[model samples]
Target: MTGKLTAQPGKREELADILLQAAEGMKDNADCELYLVNVSEDDPDAIWVMELWRSAEAHTNSLKDPAAIALIQQARPLIAAIEPVKLRPVGGKGF
Candidate 1:
């Protein structure tokens, strides 16, 4: 999963905390390989995430998990928008 999320103005810290909590919670999931990348230096309110899982099934299953759902709920208010993009890796150096 590749996604971008924009937080409400002045709510970056709160949004980051929610994301951090979510990351910690996902640590126990065997199929989860999560990457939370804060790519917007000039705009602290924007964040990007890249997630890789064992399979699409695993990713789908995680969405319904209680902890994941809770994180989404907690982040809803602070999030201005969420845009997700899915992709397949073909080849890369050291990928």
Candidate 2:
């Protein structure tokens, strides 16, 4: 899964920090293969997150986690918009 998140005008750095913290907690979930957060070079307020899960179910269940839920709550206020894209990994070197 991948997502593009636009932060409120001056909240980009705060949003990015929250996402990085969330990624650290995701390490506890073995099914969460990869969780990456990237800041756009052209647009400071634009953030991108990439996630690789063992299954769709795993991704869904992650939302139920207390840590994940808390992070979501924290991020919600700073996010202006969130656009998600689902993906299937046919074959990839790291995946």
Candidate 3:
């Protein structure tokens, strides 16, 4: 999935810290093939995340994880919204 996240106009640094820490735990999950985070060039506060899991089950399971939940809670306020759009790669390198 991929989407944008904008911090409050002046809270970019703090928001980045929270998001980075929140993602620390998710990096080790075996089911996650890719979990990339990016800051929008046009919108400094906007963060774009791209995640690829081994299966839908893995993604679902992550939702129930405590670490994931905590991270969500921590970043909720800093995030304006999570506009994730699902995708399926048809060809070429998917990494």
lDDT of 3 by residue, 1-95 (tens): 66667777776667777767656777788888877777778887777777788788899998898877887787777766667688976657865
Looking at model 3, residue 81 earns an lDDT score of 63
Please identify model 3 stretches exceeding 4 Å from their true place: none
Q: What is the overall TM-score of model 2 with all chains considered together?
A: 0.96
Candidate 3 residue-wise lDDT at 92: 77
Local distance difference test values of all predictions, in order:
0.82, 0.94, 0.75
- Residue 72 in candidate 3 has what lDDT? 77
Q: List clash counts for every candidate, in order.
A: 0, 0, 0
Model 2 alpha-carbon drift over 4 Å, by segment: none
Find the candidate with the highest lDDT and give its number: 2
Worst 10 residues of 1 by lDDT: 33-42
**TM-score, cand. 1 vs. native:** 0.85
Distance (Å) between predicted and true CA of 38, model 2? 0.3
Residue 64, model 1: lDDT of: 97
Clashing pairs in 1: none
